[model samples]
Target: TSIPSLPGISTMESLREAMPYFELILDSGCSQRARQFLCTLLEPECQPLGSSVTPPCRNTCKVVAEECSDFIINILDLSQIFKCDNYPDSEDECINLARGDQCFSKETSCGDGSCIPKRWKCNGVLDCKNGIDEVNCTTCNKYQYACESKDSCIPLEWRCDGNADCEDGSDEINCHQEEEMVMHSHASPCPAGELRCVDGRCITLQQICDGNKDCSDGADEANCRIQYKS
Candidate 1:
């Protein structure tokens, strides 16, 4: 069962006043009171701004279901592509779109004889049944492709060779390359006095110079002079 919404009287003037105070405090490095107030606001089981029935909120300040969704969608479109009014809503129109002159191209020879419109280009999955939607994604090979397999795929590479191929190189996944572990020229398998290599990579020496001896050949203090004062 849905919980009943609480209501309250919140004039635009009250929201305006509250907004300014909160914004000013946020702008200033927070004080203890401010932090406590923010903590309460961020608490999971907090109540709405008013009791009984909540006051209406604006787009950015909205608590309304549809307005809130549209507001968030608007904000999201600033950085990411969102399907908009320009998209064809009719299924027939979308299906026939490929046959129209608007989808023509002589330069690209796609698998299904046609390609996705240049405007729609990231290839996560195919939009067309023939998989012609991913025309530009067929180049990966040599560097260990995931699927640069058959002659039918454009760039003639990613066609199913039991392996994938692409050179930003993401097709053949998790083929980890082994890096050769280099031993320092001064390294004696057993070291003394925290004496390890420091060519800038921060590899700490395995041995320590506590006194007497540690690294087989007193390599820790071999050439040092000791002075004692009473």
Candidate 2:
């Protein structure tokens, strides 16, 4: 098993004991995500540095839990041992399998029910499952305003004008002066290079795309593009 497995099973004896659980999943022909998730935790990728071990992302575990719950939990009677929340969701890097992805508070969405890191949104690659992250990366036309949802382009004058031109009502998510002031005040408390959440929480830039919501407003992970870096 991996050094820091969710189950804390690091010894070969423990791994052999866990073999039955994995065999059941393999025999069931579960989704690739589920299979890969189990394999990653049970037999993680070989890295030169032990600290380089990459655990499965929490979101991926959640997906697998939901997808294979009936089999791994109900049918296999392993609910007591295989809870998905045992894994770390953030504060460090982990393996990411972008499906059923949810954005963090104040974080941008890919307009297709998936969320990514702000830096990855249009860094010249398609990170969103539907390629929405790369769309409209450029500024809208002279007369148009880019919607907060990043899925639509509308007339600039339509913004904050009391009309709902954007489908997500994001055109007015921050229309109140009090809210802007709150954002500004909250921002002041955060150190430089750190993102201030809508609720006044400070998070590191490294935490942005680690597949977790560090900010209550979810701003730390908005528009994160998932791409292989060279």
The alpha-carbon root-mean-square deviation between model 1 and the true structure, to one decimal in Å, is 22.3
> Residue by residue across 1-230, what tens digits does model 1's lDDT show?
22232112134443343444445544554222233222323232444786332211111111112111222222312211112232233443222223323333322223454333331232355545556645545443333222212122223233223354443232332222100112332445322212232232222121122234333444432332210110
TM-score of candidate 2 relative to the true fold: 0.38
Model 2 residue 60 CA deviation (Å) reads 0.7
Give the winner by lDDT: 2
RMSD of 2: 13.2
| lDDT values for all models | 0.29, 0.57
Expressed as tens digits, the lDDT of each residue in 1-230 for candidate 2 is: 34455464556766576678767776775444567677777677787865657777765665556445546644223453367576666636777644356654434577866555544555466756678777767566645655544556776556557888877664453445323423655426655435466777766433544557777656554554321121
CA deviation > 4 Å runs, candidate 2:
1-3, 6-10, 50-52, 73-81, 99-230
